[model samples]
Target: MKDLGMNLALSAEEKSLLELITPELVKIGKDRSKLIPILQLIQEKLAYLPGEAIHMVADHLSISPSEVYGVATFYNQFRFNPPGRNPVKVCLGTACHVKGGDIILENFERKLDIKEGQTTPDREFSIERVACVGCCALAPVTVVGQTVHGHMQPSKVEGLVLRARIEREKQQREKQKNESSE
Candidate 1:
């Protein structure tokens, strides 16, 4: 793939990812209309859109990198950074707002030491604010992973963060145990 004059030096992992996705890119064809599909495919495989993948897509479609970035950013479904093992979504709907959802969100930020839309350095947790989680009756809600937590209070943030860490550690240990058995 052409670097488009960016002179990017891809690491071994990036090169491997590019190699894995190149065939799918070819099968999907290079029409401009396929840009979104190409990006989706890459994101599906990599869990996020990396800069190298963006440049490759731009080059493949004969489009500018800025154009690709514009489209990607326009859609909230695309994530530029890798998602954390545990995702925490704080709802800020009208009901949640009235119930102090903002405070709950801030508590999570302080406890996680990362702002909304960012993942922790260890990739353990990520926090984001959502307009609504459709659980207004359970206003002031935070959803960790797939589980919905209702009636959230600022005081609960530490417990929630701690639970997520414990869960992740347990999962890791299980994975390691399985690997050893194999």
Candidate 2:
């Protein structure tokens, strides 16, 4: 995609959100001290900070792009990319590591063809590794959406992907059936 500068070819919804936030940004004014708050505000409003929003914030704050990105990256709470429909978090805590958590994470990455903290092209899945989830007994744990899979194996990742695909297909079929019935 070509560099879209401030607009970034944002969706209609994104544009509307930008318009709504623009006034607040003007109120906040350009201050280095306000950077984090601005980022948080944008994330809360847009779910994730889009490229255009970041640029707009940086421009409004009279800061460099690197400064904005640097601050955003420093905080784990900030998510640069949009989330997928399904958020999968793999635990990499000490217990999980002992149980081959890395193996499980790699399996998920290979299966989804996306690295940790990435969403798939179709936005069907996103997978990331967490330091700990306070469930050591559930070592090698994988959390897909709100469902926790304990004692997870690399093979289980395949089954999970397959199941998700099946479920999505089922939903799509049902929607199509309903449309045709109408």
Candidate 3:
């Protein structure tokens, strides 16, 4: 894998992902018909279809990059970029909207200093709006990683953001301490 010369050394996860994608691509065969299946397999493994992965898929299918991307764009399930370390998703389903979900979304954007669909410069977090998260009863919900905060109000967003920041800082400090000790 190092001999492939992509310049940047592949992370452990990246190397494992490549190993997973390579065989599946081969087993499925290199045809246009397998494009979506290939994309699905990649997304299932990585939660997103990266640029290099897209190029590899195109090459395998004997299709142009535009064609591969065109098919992927038609599907909303596909994400082109990797998710942030902490993904913050605001629900915009009908129930949530009636409960001021839009306001909650705006509050997140303002606090994070990045609009929806964008990650912070430090890549500590990302913000996205989703149609539903199966918590309609808990309208105006915001999900950060695996934790859900329901009945969110614009005024309460600061606390949520601040708590996440504090928790992440603590984790970082602990990690540094452990590494230094080692």
**Maximum-lDDT candidate:** 2
**Candidate 2, overall lDDT?**
0.83
Give TM-scores for every candidate, taking all chains together and pairing residue i with residue i.
0.79, 0.88, 0.84
The lDDT of each candidate is: 0.82, 0.83, 0.81
Tens-digit lDDT track of model 2 for 51-167: 887789889988888788878877888876566678889999999999999999999999998778667767788777899988899898988988899999977899999999999
Colliding residue pairs in candidate 1 = none
* Model 3 Cα lDDT, one tens digit per residue, 38-71: 8999989877776678788888988898888888
Among residues 3 or more apart in sequence or in different chains, the pairs in candidate 3 whose N, CA or C atoms overlap within 3 Å are none
Off by over 4 Å in 3: 1-12
Per-candidate Cα RMSD to the true structure, in Å, reads 5.2, 3.5, 5.4
Greater-lDDT candidate between 1 and 2 = 2
Ranking by TM-score: 2, 3, 1
